[model samples]
Target: MSPSSCAVLCAAVLSPCAIAQTSSSPSVPAQVAGQLPTIEIRANQDEARADLEAEQALTPGGVSLVDGESLRQRSVVTVGDMLRYVPGLWTASGSTGDSSFISSRGSNLDATNYDGNGIKYLQDGLPVSAADGNNHNRQPNPLAASHAVVARGANALTYGASTLGGAIDFTTPTARDGAPNELLLQLGSHGQRQGSVTLGKVVGSFDGLVSAETRRFEGYRLHQKQERSSLYANGGWQLGDAVHTRFFATTIDNQQQLPGPLTRQQWLDDPRQAEAAAVAGNYRYNVDTWRLANKTVWDIDADSKLTFGLSYENQQFYHPIVYAPPFFSLLIDTEQRTLGSTVRYQRRMGSHDLLVGMNLARTTVDGGNFSYVPGGAQTLSTSVANRASSLELFVMDRWQFAPNWTAVYGAQGVSTRREVRDSNLKGDFNSINPRAGLIHQLSPSNQLFANVSRVYEAPTFYELQDQTPGAPPNTLLEAMRGTVFEVGTRGKQELGSRNRWNWDVAVYHTRLRDEILSRDNPTAPGTSLSINADRTVHAGIEALVGASFALGGSSAHRIEPMVNLTLNHFRFRGDSTYGNNVLPAAPKVAVKGEVLYRHADTGFFFGPTFDLVSSRYADFSNTYRVDSYALWGLRAGWTGKDWDVFAEARNLANKNHVSQFSVRDVASANAAILSPGEPRSLYVGARLKF
Candidate 1:
């Protein structure tokens, strides 16, 4: 099959009848062939990916399962790069190794770094975000994930997540997914290189997989060098016919140089130049993490199952920044330990399906900040010692009331507690959220759905506290709560028996109270902190469609066309400071398009891709703004049973534009708030399987 054709059916092929084979005729009366040789079967029958896809198809809201195998055919390096095809998601890259600013449905639109407050992140159903609702771009490497599932809005309640941005879960490959010994290498512009070795196999009743990787990049901008090494492994064992256990472990060491944002004039003059302030203090970031986890599933009966999990993680962070003041430069050191667990039960009763789940997590941080002086004693600025805990309980039911209609109802209760010892601040937040939806099947392959839900988001430790001068910690930072109303339709269709198409579309509106926003202060030397807004409104429309058709009446030649669009409308509601002003940093319209040609004979495919972003305001005042921009790129690749090679080129037109911007109250001559987009670059990579 052609790669373009496979892309459209990546998940649709996992229907119930596709994976299971049944025998015909009566077992009691079987015709015996001439002395059939006894065949000893010793293998693990694990169908995790298919099961996951089947589960996702039941959601009555916008959801997607991205095929990691298809993404491997491109120059994918960061989490942001992998999410380009997902509509309504914005991921803007910073430096080579810096965390990308990520948002969904207008949540945390201006958060520049480490903002996962409105979104929940999970690795195999275990939370990766800390109990304090803080998350970074360090876990679940895209290279190691076999697939990714995105549950939009209240649909994530099935996974024990209660947030406005919903949840994203990354699943690893197992022996059943054709994982085997392999080697891969990638080389690109700006002195970039990446290499990895992976091993996988199944022996008797046990299956295991492991991978080790090293990556380095000189970066497109000056002073932005990055290096990282990571190790990941997982093993599974069948304890009995109805019970299975799995274990996972991972470690990563990363270091990266920081090239701060630049002024509009500076970017136009020399986009590659690093901010002078960053170079003066030798600004940099480093992280070291170790994690271990275990999960077990029991088939309680023919119609029910039980799942449980436990995990522990330890991480250390080192960050240094240069700011103007009597304090010169600040060096921050933090150590955090987290423990988490999950329990779930699923059952099927006639035409109704039910799920009940609970999630628990706790995190503790020991950290401090110090003033750095050349050849002098280090002076202590502040100390941090805090603990955070989270608990969630959820229940959901899907009822097929009629042959062509289904209704879903779900509810979740969440409780979060934060304890700060150094600053003597404490907070406890609790809430109950509910959701309801209806699904109507128009045909065997088409469906339409609508839903209403409520979400509550608590403030993270970073948002509740201040690190800059003259801005003190706000103990009054209240949690944000909101209601969501959404409607969508998604399905597959066949044309002329040989051509097919798949589509997904959704529109939603959200009203929030006590919205948290980060506003930059041009008068200050550093970035802005967070504050509570009186009220806000967020609305957006997301759409994606792809079609595969034979070219020129030839079955051997095929063409695929794809397009995705996100339209956003976000504003504040009657606030004393800003009334009904559009939120900053989020583009009003974003679009993506692709056209590809594929040949079935040699497994070859080539394509052209483009992205367009509309102009955006710089602040709540709506005085200054960034201009709209467009980017173009090309990609080509060949895949075989055991090997694959790919080459891609980005920014073919060499457009000079601002890729990302910092939100501020006002723009001035000295306060630089722009990050330049990368110049034209090329990348080539290959993978070999044994």
Candidate 2:
């Protein structure tokens, strides 16, 4: 097992074996014929000390974790290429897929309100809807995920919801977590193809999982096409040792052929112009979702524990479009539903560790739209509805105060309510958020950290009941706010006797208030409005480093290297309209690099990657700008025993860039192009396990 001696024998067999043996493990029996798959030394050292104590208690905010074997060695598909080494994220390409306007250190993507850009989107923890909230449908699929966690600014205020630009958790994949029985296939380049299958079972005490996938693409421009299909199922049971029950279902179908956005004189005249008179659209989407959950764990005797949960969700959307002229042929339909509940209490009081929580949520939304007029009928038809509710109470504590210091205090008390039943409008808000952190352990592998936080945001429901006829219907000017501050350091070492290293660094600052700005209507001269300016400020820094080694004498031949970086800064404080601009999908700098090689007894693997982005300002009065690019990718793999095969190459430089921009003129200065991305591609796949 090479790969750096199988990562030092999987970090000395998972380094921390006794967190009450994770609920008293017992249930080991599955060493069927041709054995060879038994290694659970305390479940690999308590999952490597619970992943280094959850990365040193989330290192003062700004977290990142991408597992599933690094998304199959970086063959990441979408979700902005799996957040391209995440660091003040800002993925691009919209009009369907890979669109995320994330802000962390140097805020201001409109002064990041709606929860201080402390973003939020979750799949396993529920909640996922940013498609129209304008985060552009970020769906990064490594076959739908087995891991993803990101929590940025103000350390995401201990997850009691309310983002100031940070939060993402997607975990999907289960079946008592052993997920097996599978099939997959692939083909590459602009003609791409993919197919998948999965099935799992344990039929006795109930445990099941089923999956399906289909994909196709023939793009890189010229008639562009894309297709998708998905189906999923989940089940769970074990309702006796303190309860557990679950159910989930999913469905998604899509069709696309929208080669619609050009004009740099049609991309310098005919860059394979196919019907390039521009503005041709077609899309069909269907989504069905259902979830029911119940969880309870109360065993207050051995180290204290208590948890309670309840969940429900429903979502739907439909779209029809054409876009050209005063906006033509458009029909949109939407629906959302949510119900949630949570209660938690945790304890391990010796060096102090506590958690208390309460949460409640309610959401309902309705949609409508119809507009035609490209030589015909249906001039307009509109209907809308809205509802929202939230409640929260939180408390957190860590305190180890000595033995290398540690402290983490948190507080949250929030309440919100909104209703816009056909523009009759109603609103209410209340908040009290606070956070504090400190960490130090300058040895045992080093550490240091700091934090401070405050956040709030409200307004969605299409930014308060969007009416769209000269705008402004159920308005509340603005109410976004944020205050964050942070500092960091991290380390790990052992590089000499055959490598191993890890590093992380951070810096952040933010200040904002009221934010949100979009203008033109100085009393209607062709309408357009959204107010609440007043302040802004941002700052950034992020760094990551990694290494691994071991080649010659086995342990399965290995190598790994990684680097990630980001730096950003923003302004705009008074009399705004992008005067001190620099925040329109801000991407001041970004970098990523990776190299991997593995061969555990002929289970060959290879990886190479590089991604960089810089250059910013795509409208919002920053007067348009979009340049800077770099991309390269490759991945290869093969394994046996349970079978696996893979290959990939993406955007290996065929960069023409420009993923999002707008400014159809408040008086001409040109800028009307939406969705222009994709220029290189390849894929090849295979997988099986039983």
Provide the overall lDDT of each model, using Cα atoms, as 2-decimal numbers. Answer: 0.76, 0.59
- Residue by residue across 205-262, what tens digits does model 1's lDDT show? 8989999999999989998999999999999998988788999999999898888888
| Reference-based TM-score of each model | 0.91, 0.32
Question: In candidate 2, where is summed lDDT lowest over 10 consecutive residues?
Answer: 20-29
- C-alpha-based local distance difference test score of model 1: 0.76
Q: Which pairs clash in the backbone of model 1?
A: none
Tens digits of lDDT, candidate 2, 195-276: 7788878766678787888878766666566677777777777666555556666666655554555555565555445433
lDDT comparing candidate 2 with the true structure = 0.59
State each model's C-alpha RMSD to the native: 8.7, 24.6
Clashes of each: 0, 25
